[model samples]
Target: MRILVTGGAGFIGGHLAERFVIDGHDVVVLDNFDPFYDTRIKAHTVERCRERAAGGDGSYRLVEGDVRDADVVAELVEEVDYVYHQAAQAGVRPSVEDPRKYDDVNVDGTLNVLDAARDTGIERVVLASSSSVYGKPRYLPYDEDHPTTPVSPYGASKLAAERYACSYSEVYDLPAVALRYFTVYGPRMRPNMAISNFVSRCLDAESPVVYGDGTQTRDFTYVEDVVEANVTLLAEDAADGEAVNVGSTDNIEIRTLAEEIRDQLAPDLTLEYEERHDADADHTHADISKANDLIGYEPTTTIREGVWKFTEWYRNDRDWYEPLVLNS
Candidate 1:
């Protein structure tokens, strides 16, 4: 099958693209290579995907463009058998500072993708949503039926995108599935995220900063599991027009996560705690029963295993991963 992966140069998107290539599917990656993080990392991601494709029966192509470009989205949608929409202005805190950019890229860009898919008769679209849409979670282990009261602009935009996907599916009979991802972490993770930041800081023998006493909990899903969910939904007929959670059922406190990283990399480093960001959720856990039922999705990586893998990559493999230093 010919697959189009939006934001395919980022962590999850890059891994997903490589998997599709190894599975003998032709893949086209669309990314604007936004400067939110370094574009060099994304370049490396594309290079790795191309290398993987070289040994397989599949081919890979990179189309440098923004999802907001309707013409580009339509043209890509018309050519691909399936669309994996992963492009967005990620991060809750950053979105709080620049809500309009989030709205423009996450919401309007998603509408463009869905509209293009609908117009071109694309078979299926797998959207990358977020657990943040559930806000503080009125109930533990948020299910698909849970109300979406997002606390952050990023979450709100993601919710809006998911709603648009559902609406497209209902009104135009488009086959679209929105997968609400939890706190995904692994090698090639964005440097701004908690796990990545902690791991990098620990490796450098620098004290990592934690917010809100480090009591906040998150169901940290591995990138491979997240990619597998998207791949599974691509062919799942029953998942059409449905939103499902893609996450590990395991939830861990932020303090525990920092401790784990410290134990592995910097045993003597002490963590510094600060006030939590207003847009940040206190806790998040996903009920992935719907994903299991529809697409046989199950998270295979434990937090310890995932963190170890990421550390290994950072130390021995990821020569390009430079630790980002942020002002406190």
Candidate 2:
């Protein structure tokens, strides 16, 4: 299989790209190396993909380009069997500062990808949506049927992108599946994420900042589990034109999660509580039954296990960390 993964150099996308390559599928990664966090991390991800592909029967190609470019997206879509549209301007807080950039990339860029997929004869497109689209959930474990009342520009952009994908699926007969991923964390996590920030701070003996009262919870899905859900969708046809939630189904309080990380990485360090951002959701719990029914997706990583694994990686992988001063 020939697969195109946009934003393939990012955390989740990188994992998916490497997994596909290891499974003996030709993979093409298109990433602009967006300066959201650090481009070096993305570059390292691409290098890892190259290393994995070197030993497998599959091949990997990295194309440094933006997804917002219609010509680039169309040209790449023409050569792949499946398109995993993972490119976007991520981060809720950052999006709050600059909403137009998020719209241009997440909404308009998604349209470009879908339009190209439609123009070409690509049947399946897997879009990366977010649980943020649900806002403060009226009910626990948000399902696909939950109302989409995005509280942030990031969430709004994702909702718009998912709508565009579904619209293309309906109007052009292009099969599209939008996977609303919960808070994902694991190896190669971006520095801006809570888990990564907490872990990094703990390692540096710095007090990890806890936003809000810390009672707010999140359904933290491991990166490997997310990759599994995405890979399963490639072989699934029943989920076309539908939105599904990809999560671990294990919701944990932010404070609890921070304590776990601190205890595991720095037993002596304490966490500092701070006011939460206004755009932050009080909670995010995904009802992943739809994903299970559609793709037989089941999460296998617990919070403790995921944190341990990430801490282990962080301790051993010094190359990716050397560029940034942890305590500074």
Candidate 3:
């Protein structure tokens, strides 16, 4: 199989690209290496993929480009069998500061990918959507049918991208699947994320900041499971034009998660509570029934287990840590 992964140098995208190549597929990664996080972190992600490619029998390639560039997208779409569109401007707090950049990258970039897929006759597209699209869910486990009332520009832009994928599937006969990834963590988590931020603070023995009384819950999914779900979708016939929730049904409170990290990584660390952050949701849990039915997707990591795993990786993977910004 020939696979084209947009944002292939990103946290999740890099992992996904590595998995595809390891499975004997020819892989091409397209990423602009946007300064969303430290470019060094993104560069390290690509370096990890390069290591995998060096170790594997299958061939791999990386193209430094943005998905918003229609010409670049179309050129790459012409070379691959399946298109995994994972590139987007990420993070909620950052989106609040600059919403137009989110719209341009997440919304317009998705449109570009879809149009290129249509023009090139790519059969399948797997989009990395987000649980933020569900907003404050009225129910416990958010199903694929959950109403999408996005609270942040980042979520809104992602929802728009998913809609575009579905629309293209209908109009251009391009089969597409959108997976709403919930609170994904583990190796290569973006530095701006709560887990990464908290871990960095803990490493320095600084009191980690907590928002909203730390009672908010999240359905944190591990990155390996997310990669497996994407791969499973490629072989499943039932996923066409489907939106699946890629998450464990389990939920963990923010305080419990933080304490677990502290105990595992820095036993003496304490948390500093702050006023609730804007654009932050109270809770998120996913109903994976659709994913299970379509792609046999099931999360293999619990919150406690995942936190330990991520902490271990964070401590060992100093190359991913931004030295200049440390304690800044």
Query: What lDDT score belongs to each candidate, Candidate 1 first?
Result: 0.89, 0.90, 0.85
- RMSD, every candidate, angstroms: 1.5, 1.4, 1.6
Q: Give the TM-score of candidate 3.
A: 0.95
* Model 3, span 143-193: residue lDDT tens: 988899999999999999998888888888889989999999878777767
Q: Quick one: how many clashes does candidate 2 have?
A: 0
For model 1, name the residue pairs that clash: none
Q: What would the per-residue lDDT of candidate 1 be over residues 172-277, giving only the tens digit for each residue?
A: 9999999999999887777778887887788778998899999889899999889888878667788898888999999999999999889878899999988887
Q: Lowest-lDDT window of 10 residues in candidate 3? A: 319-328
Tell me which of candidates 2 and 3 scores higher on lDDT: 2
Query: How do the candidates rank by TM-score, highest first?
Result: 2, 1, 3
Worst ten-residue run, lDDT, model 2? Answer: 319-328
The C-alpha TM-scores of every prediction are 0.96, 0.97, 0.95
Count clashing residue pairs in model 1. Answer: 0
**How do all the candidates rank in terms of lDDT, highest first?**
2, 1, 3
